[model samples]
Target chain A: MPIQAITPDYHGEVRDRLENFHGNQLVYVGWDRHLLFCSAVAFPLAPDTRFAQLRDEAMAGVFGLHPEWAQVDWGRVSWLLDGEPFEPMLDRPLNEQGIGHKSLLRMQTPDLKGFQSAGV
Target chain B: MAAKKLNIKDKYRLLTRDLDWEFSYQDRKEAFPYEEFEGIKITDWSKWEDPFRLTMDAYWKYQAEKEKKLYAIFDAFAQNNGHLNISDPRYANALKIFLTGVSPLEYQAFQGFAHTGRQFGGVGARIACQMQSIDELRHVQTQIHAMSHYNKFFDGFQDWSHMHDRVWYLSVPKSFFDDARSAGPFEYLVAISFSFEYVLTNLLFVPFMSGAAYNGDMATVTFGFSAQSDEARHMTLGLEVIKFLLEQHEDNVPIVQKWIDKWFWRGTRLLSIVAMMMDYMLPNKVMSWKEAWEVYFEEAGGSLFKDLARYGIRMPKYAETTEKEKEHVSHQAWWIFYNYGQAAGFHTWIPTDKELDWLSEKYPETFDKYYRPRWELARQMEAEGKRFYNPGLPQLCNCCQIPMGFTEMDDPTQIAYRQTVYNGERYHFCSDGCHDIFVDEPEKYVQSWLPVHQIFQGNCGGPGVEDVLRDYYRMNVGADNLDIKGSPDEQRWNAWKGVA
Candidate 1:
C-alpha cells in the first residue's frame, strides 16, 4: 500500500543513490552458509574493478581469516547476483556484467561446508 | 448555603474535560488538522475514556515522593561504591547500552507524547498524553541519574548521546524512535504505546530489572521499581486507545492492524539488543532470552491477541517467525557485535565456558549444533593470539538498521536475505517482517540515514574506519571498544579487586 499522507505528492529522496558515492557503487557480497563472518560484507567499489580483483584482494582479507578458507576450491565456486544464478567473467569489469549499485552477490562453495558442517 | 465536597472523578473531569471549548468560530477540522489524514474515522470524542484519573497536582505530589526515595537510594548506592558490588565488570556494559540506547528513547517518547497530545481533539486523550509526557520526562531524568554513578568509573558511558547520533550499532535504537516520531499521531500511539508498551514492554523491562537485581546493581533495580506504576498506567492507556478507535468506526480496524504488524516487527528487531544483553551481557544470568520470550511474549501476548480478536485484530503478522527467531537472535546479535567489536561503543567477548553451557542447556535445540562451534573456534583463535574481528562493514537492513545477521528459522545456516526494488533502487531486509514494512512504505524508509551507508559515502568524519570511530563517533580508541579481555575496564576492575 502507498503511504497515506497530508500531501498526495509525497516522494522520498533516495539517500543511497549511486551518484552520491564518489565514483563508487555499493556491492554486498556474502559467502553462503558461512555463519562465522556473521553477515554479508558491503563494499564501495568502482564499477570498473574486475571480478578477480574483488576475489583475490578484497575477499581474501575477510574470508581468509577462517580456518577452512585454504581448503576451498575456487573452480567449483558458484555465484548468484541479486538472487539469480550468474557466472561472472573473471577479467571483466562489474558494470559490464550487469552488476549495478547496491547489487548483492552471493558465493557458494561446493563440498566445503562451514567448519565441520556445523554452519560455523 | 454549605459548599459540597467533590470526589476525585468529578475533580478530574472539571480540571480536564471541562477546559476544552467548542469550535464555534474555527473549523473543527482545522483545529485537529491531522486527525483524518490517516483515514481513521473518530465518530465521537465522548467515547474516548480517560484511562487514569490522577489530577496534575496529585501527579506532581506522587512523583515528588518517589523522587525523594529514589534519590536517597542513588546516594547510598554511590556512597557505598556500588560499582564494585556488581557480579562482574562486564555487567556494566549492559548499563552502557541502556544509558546510551534506551534512555535517549525515553526523551524521544517525551517529545512524541507532547506533540501528539495537542493534535488529538478529545480532551481526555490530551490530558492523558500530557500526563504520560511528563512521566516520560521523569523517566529519562531518573535513568540518567541512576547511571551517572557508573559513569565516573566506566568508559562507554561518557559519549553515549554523541554516539547515539553517529555510531553504527546505536542507529538501531535511534532510527526506531525517529521513525515513530515522524509518523502520524494515531500511528505513533499504536506503534509506541499499544504495540511497544502494552504488548512488548515486559520483554524489555523484566530482563533489565531482574538482571540488575541478580547482578547486584541496586540503582537500576530501584529505577525500574519507580517506573513500574507509570508503565502500568501507560499500558492501560494503550488498551483504551485501541478499543476507542476500534469501537468508534469499523474502518479503523485494518489501519490499526497494519500498524500493529509493523510496530511489533520493529519492536522485536529493536529488542534483539536486549536479547543479547539478557543472554550474554549479564554476568550473573537471569532467564535465557528464549525463556523470557516464552513467558513474556508467547504466554502473555498470546492472551492479548485472543482478547483483541473480538475487534478483528489477530496476532502480529510475523509473530510465528519471531517465536522461531527467539532461539537464535541473541546468539546471532552477539556474534555480529563480537565480530565488529572494534567499531562498537561497548566491549564484546566470547562467553565463558560456564555461560556457554548455560546457553546450550537453555537452547538445547540449536545452540549445541550451530552456535557452540563458532564460539569454540573463537576461543581457539583467541588462544593463538588471533582474536577475530571482521575487517569489513556489514550490510544493514534498510528498515531496522541492524546488520543483516539474522538467519533463516528453518535453516539457521543460510542468511535470511529478502530484497525488493523500489523506483529502480534495490533494498534488502534481514527478514520478511522488515521487508513487508519497507514494501508498504518505501517512501518513508528510503530516506533512512543508515550509518554504514553514510560512512561509505564519506558523510562521516573520514574515509577510514578508525577515523570515523575516533573523530565522528567520539569513541576512545583501545578504551571504550574491542574485546574485554585485556581492556582498561577489566584491568581497572582487577586492580581494584587486588587480582594479579
Candidate 2:
C-alpha cells in the first residue's frame, strides 16, 4: 500500500497562529566560539553580497575584539556551515551555498595556505 | 522592488500546500528513501499539522529580531565583566555542563531535522522539520555566544568540542545522540522530539535557567529565556507528531509504544547529568533535583501520558523505579564526577558545610543515612593531605556509557548490574532499561564507541593517563580540573575579595 500523509484542516486559532508567526530567525556570523554579529538584517535568500564582505561586516562595531580578528588573515580562514567549508564567493548569494536562516558561518583555519589559494 | 501585500493564511497555504508535487519522474520511494522500515503507518498526508505554519520570511524576521535582542544582552554582559558578577565561581560548572553535554546535542538535533525535513512525505511535516533545523542551529550559536565570556576567566570551557568526543563521561551524551542519529527518521522524531523534548526537556532546561537567575549569570538567563519560547513550539510539534502517528493507523500504536518505552529510558538516563548539576553543582540551589523531577516529570508528564491512554499509550517502562531513583541518582552521578574530577575538564569539590546541611535538609530520605558518611571519610582524607583519585579506569555500562555506580533498587547499597551476551561477548548495563535497549537493537549498539574499551585498545592518545588527559582530551591538570584549595578561577575569586 502507498503511504499518504494528511495535512489537517487549518482554520480558527491554528490558522491565526500560522498567519502571524512570532519566531523570526537571525543570520549569525562567528569566529571560533564567539558570536561576532547577529543581525535583523534580512539579506535576500539569494544575497548579492559575498561571504568575504560579511566577514568584514562581522568586525564592524566591536573594534575592541574585532581588530585582532582582522589581523588574523581571514582569507586563510574557511567559512563553514556545519563544520565543512563552502566557497561562498563562488556561491555569491549565500542561498546558492545552502546557507539559510539560523545557519552558522563558522570560521576555521583548516589548512592555512590551502584556503588562501581556494579563495583566489 | 516593492513590499508584497500578502495575507498570512494565504502565504502559509502557498508555501506549504502549493509547494508539494507528486513524484512522476522517479519512483517515490527512490526520491524519499528512508521514511519507511520503522513501521509507522501514515495513511493521509493531510492529517499532519504544521503547527507553526511558519514561512521563511516570517521565520527569518521574527527569529532575527529575537537574536538581535539576545546578542545585545550578550554584549552588555561581556562589557561589564559579568563573569565576576556571578554568585559563586562553582556555579560556572553548570554552564560547563551546558556547553559540553547539552549544546552539542542541539547540533545533533539540527542534523536530525535536516534529514527528516527531506525524508518525510508530508509537506507540512517537512516544513516543520526544516524550521526546527534552523532553530536547533540557532540554539547552538546562541548558547556558545552566551557562555563564551566565561572562557576568558575560567578553565574547562576551552576545547569542549574535542573533549565532548574523547572524554569518558562525555561519551554518554555523544553516544545517545549517535544512537538517535543512526536510526530512521520517524524513530529519530520519536526518540528525540517526543521522548526527549516533550517528556524530559523541562527537567534539563528549567532548573538550570532558574539556577542561572539565582546565581546571577545574566548571560545564561538571557539565552535560556530566548530558547524557552522556541522550546514551547517544539514541544507542541512533538505532541502533534505522536498523535498524528497513532491516529493514522491502528498498527502504528504498538510501534509508537515500543519507541516510547525505549526512548523514555534513553532520555531519562541522559538527564542524570542535569540531576547532578541541579542538586550538587549549583552554588545557590533553585530546588532539589527531586522537587524539579516531581513537578516537571511526575506531575506534568503523568497527566500527559494519562491523556494519551485512549490512544493505547501508557507511561514508559520502568516508570516506578525511575521515580524511586530521584532521591539517589543525583548523589551517585555527582559522586562519580567528584571522585573522577581529575579525568573531567570541570572542577569538582565535596559540598561545603552549609551546602551539606542544605543537601541533608533537601534529601532527608537518603543523604545522611547513606551518602553523608562517604563524604565524611572523603573530608578526613582531604584533611590528612591524602586527596583520593581513582587510579584505575572505571568499568562503563555498554549502553549508557555511565559508570556502574548506580545502586540496586531494593538494597541501595549493592550496585545494579545487567548483562547480556551477544555474539559471545558479554555486555553489561547499569540498569534493566539500558539492557532492554541493547537486547532490542544488539546490531545497532554492539558497535558503540565504548570509551573504556577504546582506552584499553589504545585508540585514545596513549596508554598513560597524562597522555589521555593532556594530548587526547586537551585538558590541563592544575587549570582545567579540581584542585579544591585553588585553581586560577578560585584564586581570582579570592583575590577579588582581598584574601591573601
* Number of clashing pairs per prediction, in order: 0, 19
Across B110-148, the per-residue lDDT of candidate 2 in tens digits comes to 999999889988888898888899999999999999999
**Candidate 1: TM-score?**
0.99
After superposition, the stretches of candidate 2 with alpha carbons farther than 4 Å from their true spots are A1-120, B1-3
Q: What docking grade does candidate 1 earn?
A: high
Let me know the DockQ for model 2: 0.01
Model 1 misses residue B15 by how many Å? 1.5
lDDT of 2 at B473: 85
Candidate 1 Cα errors over 4 Å, as ranges: B1-7
**What's the i-RMS of each model?**
1.0, 22.9
Scoring each candidate complex against the real one, what DockQ results? 0.84, 0.01
Q: Write the per-residue lDDT of candidate 2 for residues A29-102, one digit (tens) a residue.
A: 43432211111111111244455455555333332232234456545766666345776664265555666543
Candidate 2 global Cα RMSD: 20.9
TM-score of chain A of each: 0.95, 0.48
True contacts kept of 1: 0.83
lDDT of 1 by residue, B121-192 (tens): 999999999999999999999999999999999789997788888889889999999999988899999998
